[model samples]
Every structure is written in structure tokens, then in C-alpha cells.
Target: MTITKKTVIVTGAGGGMGRATVEHLLEAGANVVGCDLNIAALAELEENPRFKAMKADLLNEAAVQHIFAQTKSEFGSIDGLANVHGIAQHATPIEDCSLAEYRKIIDVNMTSIFLTCREAAAYMKEQGSGKIVNIGSVSTTRPRPGLQAYVASKGAVESFTKALALELAPYQVNANVLHPGPADTSMLGEFTAVGSSVDDTKKEVFESSVPLGKLLQPEDIAKSVKYLLSDAAEMITGAVLHVDGGRNI
Candidate 1:
């Protein structure tokens, strides 16, 4: 847990889990740059000396590069990256899922990671040290029906992170994936099938599916992200850490 004074960039900083991670890292004394397409949710953190909110789209190449460049210019170095931004797929069969819809999900979920990781790797590799934690989903392991596209995207994240770990090992940059299961976020309700009751699906389908019988809190995922970014996990690379409450079992 030695992240004090480190500079970490967190994507999706406006969302439930992302916001939590930003808070946790700031509390741990890390200089945090929170990026999101819309950063209205992070307004309260604007006054914090250790926090910076950047409104940028991860899908844009220039925007991604700017995030890293600005981080370096302001913080002097980038020590860690937490790829907490992502999208959920509505439960829809592949046959009914338009290719356009599939591409959007893949672009946002997988491609965005590519953009950020690629930019981070450049600076990190040069510095000879860094940590990368990409937030995936337990759905890759225990996918529910009609979430084929989402599963595929997250599965790609796991593989990509492993590849990154091996390629960047020589440079002392560690890469890993954190797959969360059935988090109690607004994003969870988005996974419900069309015309289905969101509350019922959360209780009957998502909550009950977890062996722990409780939905995961965003804080649960944030703490793990902190560990993966800290000195304690320096030797950990290419690992899939599940914060899923046994949902993947």
C-alpha cells in the first residue's frame, strides 16, 4: 500500500467504481487524474490539491495521448493506471444484436483500454516502472444469457492485459486484470433484458447468483485496484484478480 505521492490516471472517474477508486487513491496520498466523457459527478473533488478531473473520450486517440501528456506535465511522472471505464451490454441474443451495437460495445470496452494502455506504455516503459490494472468483469467467466457481446469484449481485455504483462516485463511495468461481479452500480441495471424488471433482475438474477448473497460494492473493487497498484503487488503481473464474491466459481 505504498502509493503515496505517486501519480495515477483513472479512466471512468465519474462512474460509481471509478469515483470510489479516485477517492481511495487520494486518501492513500496519490496524485490522481480522473478522466471521463462527462465529469460532472466528480465536481466535488475539484478542490482537492491531489486530484485533477479531465473530460476526455477514451476512444479518441488524441484525447488518450493528451491525458498521459498532461499527467506527466503536471505531476512529473505517471506511476500507475487504473482502467476503470467500461460499458455493459443489455441482455440481447446475438442474432438480435446488431453488428453496430456489438462494435460500439467492443470499441468502448476493449478498444478504449488499448488506447489508454498504449499511451501509458510509452511513458511507463521509458521510466522503467509502472502498474496497470484494467477492470474487466466476472461475466467473462460466468456470463449470463444474451450478454455475448459484453462477454467477448471483457474476455479480450483479459487476454490483452496478459500480453501486455509479458511484453512490458523487461521494462518493469506490470499489467493485470480485475474482474468484478454483479456490482451494485447503476450500470448493473443496464444488463437487464429488454422489457425485464430491473429491480427483479438485480435481486433474482444478479444478487442471488453471487455465492456471498450480496451485490459487490464499488469500494470492494477500488480496494483491490489500490492493492494491485501498490508496492505490495509489484511482483504480481498477468494475474486475474476476481472481486466477484465467488460469482465466478
Candidate 2:
């Protein structure tokens, strides 16, 4: 089966990769539901009849619940969900990290995912099948400095995806993690920039580390997320698909 005619929800729909994923999903003829804290970006997507926009903070269970309610109310049932909402750290050493700040990151990046999965799983369980493509990062598998909270949360995302897949597999609800390399995303400005300026120094290091010798683009990630959500990946559950340009190699 193709993605066309299916209904999908994308979190963090306001940003770079999130917007790209929404666009690709639309092109595939899927009914798309986009949610973001940025009301303006969500408004832009509402212009398309195939696209529905909802303002939500995934960290808020009520807000996320409303997103599902809106989707069900408007598009019937959801066929897929892409958990893409996340934030980057400013390279604060773990030694300097605050408990409150760490908790906030975990809440935003990990707890919110659990909330979405909880709601989506219920809907998909009733439908008997669905796809969940969660976005993780290479940092989860690879060591990165001064980003303890973000990295730990991403690692949890990877772990949670596997655990959820195990629980959802009996019903054919596929769950998987997409680990991206250092992509050219807005998040990278902090990871790759140097000494009070946006520099290529970090990018260079990342580029040299990757076997592909380059930074990944948002489209690369979008394409992978699309395919994972499609029927092509029907049998691929609980697997961590790496889109990090051979960085793990």
C-alpha cells in the first residue's frame, strides 16, 4: 500500500525537518496533521486542504490529546505518526548542568514522546495496524560533549522505540527510530558553531568523522521518514535505521 490516502501526524511541524516531512507526506497524497508551538508555521500549512494544523505542546498531555482528537474528528483514523519535535543544548558541560534544566529536557524530548505514543498506540491498536517513526540522533550512539541532557533523552527515545515496538508488534503496529547524523538543521548552529560565532569547525569535525564526508540535509531525513511510514517498512519494526551518512561505520 502507498502512503496516499493514509492519515499521518507530524510533531514539531513548524521547523526545518518537520516542515520537509509534512511536504513530502502531502506529495505522497497523505492526509497530514501538523502540530507545533509556532502558530504561524502551522497556519501556513492550513492553506492546503490536505493539511490540517493544530497548535500543541507535546509536553502537555492535554494539548497532545487535543491533537489526536482533532485528527480523529477531521481525518478519521491516523495511519502513522512521526515524533520529530526536539530541542538542542548549548554545549553546557554535564558538570555545569542544573537538575531543573535536565528535567525540562527530559520532559520535552522524552516524556512528551511517551505521551504521544500512548495516545497514538491506543488509536492504532483499535485500527489493528500503524507506523511510528521516531526521530533520534547520532549522538545517542556516539559520544558528544556538553549536551548531556539532549543526548540522554535521545538515547531514551531509541530505547523507547524498541520497547514500544515489542509491545505493539503483536498487532502489527510498527515502531522504529531514525538516527540522523549531524544534519544541516537549525539545531546544528549550536552543535557545530565555535567560540561565539557560527563556524564550520564543528561541521568539519563531523564531516571528517562521517564516511560520506558531508553533513546531512533535512530532505535526506524527510525521505527516510516517509519510506519508514510507508508500507515498504511493514515488516521493519523495532529496528534503528541509521541515516547518519555512514557515521557509525
Candidate 3:
């Protein structure tokens, strides 16, 4: 848990899991840059000296560059990165899933990780050390029906992270993926079929699908992200951590 004074970049910092990670890191005494498309949700932390809220679309290459440059200038180094921003695909038959819909999911969920990780690698390589934790989904391992695009996107995340781990290993930079199962975030409801009751789906489908019989909380993921970014996990890389309450089992 020795993350004091480290500088970390957290994408999707406005979302449920992202905000929780930001808060957890700040509590651990790290200088945090919380980036998202809309950072209004993080306004409450504007007063915290350790937190910097940056609003930028990760798909834009220029904006992504600025996020890293500004982080380096402000924090002096890019020590860790937690990519938590992602989109969920609604349960839809392949016949109804258009190319546009599938591409959008891939761009948001996978391309964004590419952009951020590219920036992180450049900085972390120069510094000779860093950590990267990409947030994947448990669905990649145990996918539900009608979620082909979502599963494919997250599957790519896990593979990409493992490749990054090996590439950065020489520089002492660790890269890993975290797959959360049936989280209790707003994104959970987005996975329901069109016209399906969100609550019923959560209780009967998503919740019951887990062996632990409970949905994961945002804080649960935040804790794991913090550990991955901390010295406690210094030797860990190319690992897929399942924080999904036995859902993958």
C-alpha cells in the first residue's frame, strides 16, 4: 500500500468506479489526475489539493496527449495509470446489432485504452518504472448472451494488457487487467435487454449469476486498483485479477 507521493492518472474519473478509485488513491496520498469526458461529477473534489479533474474525450489523440503532458508537468512524473472508462452494450441479437453499434463499443472500450496506454508507456518508460491497471469485464470470461460486442471489447483489453506487461517488463513497469463481475454501478442496468425490467434483471440474472450471491460495489474495485498501483503488487504484471465475487469460477 505504499503509494504515497506517487502520481497516478485515472481515466473515467467521473463514473462510479472511477470516482471511488480517485478517492481511494487520494486517501493513500497520491497525486491524482482524474480524466473523463465530463468531470462535473468530480467537482466536489475540486478543493482537494491532490486531485486534478481533467475533462477530455479519450478518443481524440491530441486531448489524450495533453492529459499526459499536463500530468507530467503538474505531478513531475507519471507513476501509474488506471483505465476505468468503458461503455456497456445492451442485450441485443446479432441481427439487430449494426456495424455502427459494434464499432462504437470497440472504440470507446478498446481504442480509448490504446490511446491512454500509449501515452502512459512513453512517460513510464522514460521514468524507468510505472504501473498500469486496465479495467476489463468479467463478461469476457463468462459472457452472457447478446453481449458479443462487449465481451469482444473486454477480451481485447485483457490481451492488450498482457502484451503491455511483457513489453514494459524490462523497464520495471507493471501492466495488469482487472475484471469486475456484476458490479452495482449504473453501467449494470445498461446491460439489460431493451424493455426488460432493470431491477428484475439485476436480481434474477446478474446477481444470481455470481457465486457469492451479491453484486460488486465500486469501492471493491477501487481497493483492488489501489493495490495494483501500490508497491504491494510490485511483482505483479500480465495478471488478470478477478474481483467478481467468484463469478468467473
**Candidate 1 lDDT, tens digit per residue, 133-202?**
9999999888889999999999999999999999999999999999999999999999998999999999
What RMSD value applies to candidate 2? Answer: 1.5
User: In candidate 3, which residue pairs clash?
Assistant: none
What lDDT would each prediction earn against the true structure? 0.96, 0.88, 0.97
Candidate 2 collision pairs? none
Candidate 3, residues 25-111: lDDT per residue as tens digits?
Answer: 999999999999989999999899888999999999999999999999988999999999999999999999999999999999999
Q: Candidate 2 clash total? A: 0
TM-score of each: 0.99, 0.95, 0.99
Q: Name the lDDT value of residue 128 in candidate 1.
A: 100
Off by over 4 Å in 2: 192-194
RMSD of 3: 0.5
lDDT of 2 at 112: 93
Q: Tens-digit lDDT track for model 2 on 1-249?
A: 489989999998888889889999999999999888885766766778999878888988899899998898899989999998898777786777899989998888899999999999999999999999999988888867788899999999999999999999998899999999988777778664236444554555666778888888889999999999999998999999889999876
